[model samples]
Target chain A: MRNKFAEALYRLSRSDPRIHIVVADISPAGPMNEFRKEFPERFINVGVAEQSMIGICAGLALKGMLPFAYTIATFALYRPFEMVRDDLCYQNLPVTVVGIGGGVIYSTLGGTHYAQEDITIAGAIPNMSILAPCDPAEATAATEYLVGADRKGPCYLRFGKAGEPDITKDAIEPFRFGKLRYLRRGRDVAILSYGVTMGLAVKAAAALADKGKSVSVIGCPTVKPLDREGVIEVLRSHPRVVVAEENAPRGGLASEVKSVAWDIQARCALQTITLKDEFVHCYGSHEDLLAAHGLSVPAIVAAAGG
Target chain B: MSAAPRRLANDFDTTAARERCYRLRRRILDVSQHVSALHVAPAFSCMEIVDCIYHGLMRKDESGAYLDTFLMSKGHGCMTQYAILESHGTLPRSALDEYCTKDGLLGAHPDYGTPGIAASTGSLGHGLGMAVGMAVAERNAAKAKGRPVPTIYTVLSDGEVQEGSTWEAVMMASTLGVDNLVAVVDNNDFQSLGRTSETHPSFYPLVEKFQAFGWETVEVNGHDAGAVFRAVTARKGAGKPFMTVAKTVKGRGVKYMESVPIWHYRAPNPAEYKQALEILEKVQS
Candidate 1:
């Protein structure tokens, strides 16, 4: 998945001179080496200065360039709130902030690198579009969408480290900003999910279908300006909706779905499969963290009362 | 004429330029009082700096021949900027009255949509980076079109230096040899929390620090309009960015408010406002 994201960035860099990338001394680790090698003049390694990297990216954007600043999700969002608000969003600059190792992807790095609060923080900023791709294809699509979009605003693209399932094929429809993709159809319950958890939700829905339960799975690539209509339509038909995400339950997709549900006064059962408020006490990989957080297929199914 | 006295005469004559600065400051204070907003101290700190940059340093041209762009990184001090713009005749005094009011163009911060404001900044640590970009872009455009480079000036807060983002811009400006860019720090010594030294304790030997970072540095009393003007107009060193440390009082011109931390977030009451007005009026008179 990381390779696919990197490949898309590499391909995009060829055509756009305005597309620049700033790395936090982690380009090689973030799988952005190809981009660095290809566009050496544009790529900047600011050592360990995440805050400064964000500022530099804002500066680059001010110079009529689109900068995709990359860093671990935790440091990028937490350390540079003022820069994100003042430089990028307030000015409405076209700067794509890519957060790798989102959620529990940095599980081995323990609590320090966990990016549980990125979506929440990014969502709070007005005019900031948030994208959490389900897989590499979606990630590539997001990159292309951001590069070509006319309305240049701040965007946060959150992705994991590597080795994720390839749920999207090349034939899949081109990713549209602020639009959701309906993967499967059912009437009994709707599975609304994004990012890596979309795959988990799909697996859970498939399992429920085998047991004679109807299920629908919607992959929400864009979290901000969320597909309210799609979510409402799904909720209007299905009595129960399960929102699953790799991030914390608070301020994640689940809360957004619930907010939509509440606005419409829908009485359907809404379940969320997400991380609890507490940090993961154990050390492991992304899968282990998800499992511990009850974000696995079986756990999601159990949460949905299947 | 004696050399020292002649220099002093030239320097003191710049005070005549303070009429515009005073008007700007008065407008800013009036707007803040009307809206009940608390930014008068920060606003006053940058009034002379902004006035000197726009009126003294920049050359007026629709073609943008001289200093093409100016940005206020310390956005909370927008009143100073508003005053400068009004004095420059780009923005009218009527617009200054609408500051911080609902549906008004002037908010507590500098905005790009506001005429003459290059970038909008309220959140600290953003303006300098944008200024650096503007300078780089101007240089690139000049190179592409085979024209002389235009200067870019960014006004920043002394407290903003505590933010790592400012240093990143500094590093980039130095490494890229952005001699066209000039960053002026309004060294008022006070941030949101009392004095900066008591809180962060980072001693900024600004000239030495920036010199080490490959920038030509100058330290001046920010309140001295002539010194600020001179510092800004000084020739750029070869292949190096420029930084000016403008030593200033936080709540300048107001007797009770000068160097006081309370003014950082306090809007003067009716009595205090009257007192402030009287002090400023005395200076003007």
Candidate 2:
């Protein structure tokens, strides 16, 4: 997904002289390397200065220049939160802040590298659009949508580390901001998943099918400006709804669904498969950490009452 | 009364500029009378610096639009900007009269959409980095259009130097060689509650810090509009970024408030207001 974002940006920059790329100390490999090579004048690498990167992007936007500030999720959102609020959100500039390594994608590097609270941080700010793409295809589409002529505001484009599979490939609807996409339809139980966790929901749905029980897999790519009416309708039709995400259980998709269900007083049973509120002190691979924190496929199936 | 908008000329006199500063300070005191919770001392510290920029240093075209941009990173000192903008005719007299009121466009901080405000800044350590970015964009625009680069000036407080983001912008500006960027640090020697020198002893040797970072640095009396004008104009188009350490006094115009920390954000009482006005009236520009 990260590489696809760079490729999409590089392709878009070919004709738009307004597009400028700013990165921190992160090494520019793969498609990003090609972008810097092609547009050396527009590529700016403010070494290890995330706050300055955001401030600089705001200035670029002031001059009618479109700037994309790319860095890791924790560095992009946490260290320079005031900068994001003061420079970007307050002024409501058209700066695309790309935060790679969402959730536990950087699990081996310990808790410091994880980005569990990004959704909460971004959701708290007004006029901030949050997009957590599920795969490379959706990542490209979201990038294009954000950099389009009309999408003029601050936005957070959250992606996983690398090589997230194309879970949204077989979906009936194409990628659109603030829309809930259904990957598979079933009447028994509905599984609502966000970002890279959509694949787990799909696997869990198929596993439930083996027992002659029908299950639906829904992908939630746009976390902010959620499909509230669609979620209420889904709750009305389904007897059970399960939310799967790799973020902290407090303020991600699960919380949004719960809030909507509470407001409508839906009679359906709701459950969430997510990481614990505490930090993950253990070290392992991304899959290992997800399974340990109850965000795996089995956890989603269990949450669905399978 | 509003001053007529004028273009920058080669032989402008400093007496007019100083008198303008005195008038701006008086306007700031007027704002203080209306609003109780604003940084009066902080505003006084940067009055002349901002006045010189808008009235003397920054060039204006025939259309009354500034060719160069100015940002106030030290947000608490926003009354200085509001007063200057109002007097410069960019902002209306009614707006200054209604500051902090329910129907006023002006507030305790500078907002972006307000006329003459480049960026919404009050958060310390934020303006310089954005200034660097504007400088870079101006340079790019100049290179593409074959025109001279426009400058981006920002006023930061002395206490704001403690923020890490300030140095981060400093490093990036020097490395990018943003020659059109100018940062003036209002070194009033006082933070919000205490003296910066007493609290942060290692922060001295400030000019050398910018010089070492590859900037053309200068130190001058911030209250002297002529000195500031000379420092900035002497290095115009000098092929490197510039930093001016303007040594100023908090609550500069009024003797009772000068260098006093308690006067940081206080409106004057009836007796104090009377005394302050009398002192300001008797002063020579």
Candidate 3:
């Protein structure tokens, strides 16, 4: 996912001169060396100053450049929340905030490093848009879309680290930034998933299909605008609706679904297979954290019963 | 000790500008009178710093199409900028009359959509970081177009520097060697309820702090617009940025409220307003 973001940025930057990448010491560590080697001038390395990095991007955006300030998820948004809100969101600048290794991707890095609140925080911001591509292919597509996006407002791009395969059937087609894409077609239950958990959701959907329960998988890319119509469609159609994400249920995709889907009502059951409000104190790989918190495929399958 | 150049004795009319500063104070007092409450002392402390920047170095057109950019990092003192901008004809006289009202153009803090405001700031410790950003963008855009980089200026409050983000910005500015950026700290001794000096004296001797962080530093009488302008416009090597420490008095023209903390948020009563007006009106010459 990191390499996809770097490559996508490189590809888009080749055509768009306004695309500038601002990093706070992520150059030497992240997959930005390709971009750093090519456009060293455009690639600004602010050197471990997250707050300054955000401000610099807002400044660059104000100067008619589309700046993508990249770093670890928490450091990029959580640490510099005010800069993102006031300098970028409040001004409604054309700044793309790419937060790498989102959710529990940085497993061993502990609770401080994990990004469980990105989508929620991004959603709360008035002029902010959010896109969490489930896989590298969609990550590339989301990058191209946001960089070329017509809206010149603040956008937060949250995606997981590399090595995950495509979870959706159509991974490389033209994608509308704020529209929800269908991953699998079914009838009994609707699985609305965001970020890496879409992989889990797809697996759960397949498991339910084997059990004669048809589950439709909806891929949520732009969770802020939230594909509200799509959420309402699923909520109103399916007998069971399962909203899944790597974030706490309170402010993640589930909360957004509820905001637009609750009053409309589902036919039978409404459940959220999401991270518990408590911290993931136990750590191993990213998958281990997700599994321990009942987001395992079996748990999701059981939650979306026949 | 700025080592850039000093024109402390330049022909920038101290008498005339000081008189304008007095008029600016009266205008600010009048505008704040309409609003039930105002950040009077905080605004007064940085009035001349803002006035000198707008009237002295930033002689750009209203379009701001060039490299000269200014952001009020000390956004609470925006009444000073609003009043000065009106005096400069950048902002219309109507903005002052509608201040803090529901239908008003102006608010407690300066918003970017408002004329003469570069960034929305009321959140302390946010402006300098953004100023550094604007400086970098201006330089980058200029470099892309083969033009000379534009200079960036921002004014900050004494209490605002207490935030760690300010030091973070300072360190990053020095590291980047952003020569085109100039920052003026409105170092009034008082903060909200206490003397900033007594609250955190450790941050004092602020000149050494900037120099240690690799910036060209200077100290000036903040009320002296000539000194403030001279410090900002000084010619220094184009390697590191510049920060000028402008020592000032809170509630400067209002004798009774000078350095008084309550005046930071409280509006003056009718008699107090009359006395303040009398203090400023005497300087019409």
Q: Which stretch of 10 consecutive residues in model 3 chain A shows the poorest summed lDDT? A: A166-175
Deviation of model 2 at A116, angstroms: 1.7
Stretches off by above 4 angstroms in model 1 are: A28-31, A170-174, A187-189, A209-215, A265-269, A303-306, B1-19, B22-41, B59-67, B137-149, B190-204, B250-285
User: Compared with the true structure, what per-residue lDDT tens digits does model 3 show for residues B226-279?
Assistant: 877776766574688998999898888788878988988888887888888876
Candidate 2, clashing residue pairs?
A: B75-B122
Encode model 1's per-residue lDDT on A1-306: one tens digit a residue: 667777777887787777777777775644478777766657777778777677777777766788888888887777787778777887788888888888878888888888877888888898788998988778878877888855468999898867787776632345677777877777888888888878788789889998888887788899987888878887888888888887777787789888888999998898877788887877786778889877788887886679
Give the per-residue lDDT digits (tens) of candidate 3, residues A96-170: 888888888888889998887778788789999898988887888888877775765899999787687866546
lDDT of 2 by residue, A201-288 (tens): 8889988999777888888888888899879988998999999888887878899999999999999999988888888887787878
Q: Native-contact fraction for each model?
A: 0.48, 0.76, 0.68
Candidate 3 or 2, higher TM-score: 2
Runs in model 2 with CA error above 4 Å?
Answer: B1-10, B236-238, B281-285
RMSD of each: 5.0, 3.4, 2.9
Backbone collisions counted per model: 0, 1, 1
Scored by lDDT, model 2 comes in at 0.85
Error of 1 at B9 (Å): 15
DockQ each: 0.42, 0.78, 0.65
The residue pairs found clashing in candidate 3 are A1-A162
Candidate 2 - CAPRI tier? Answer: medium
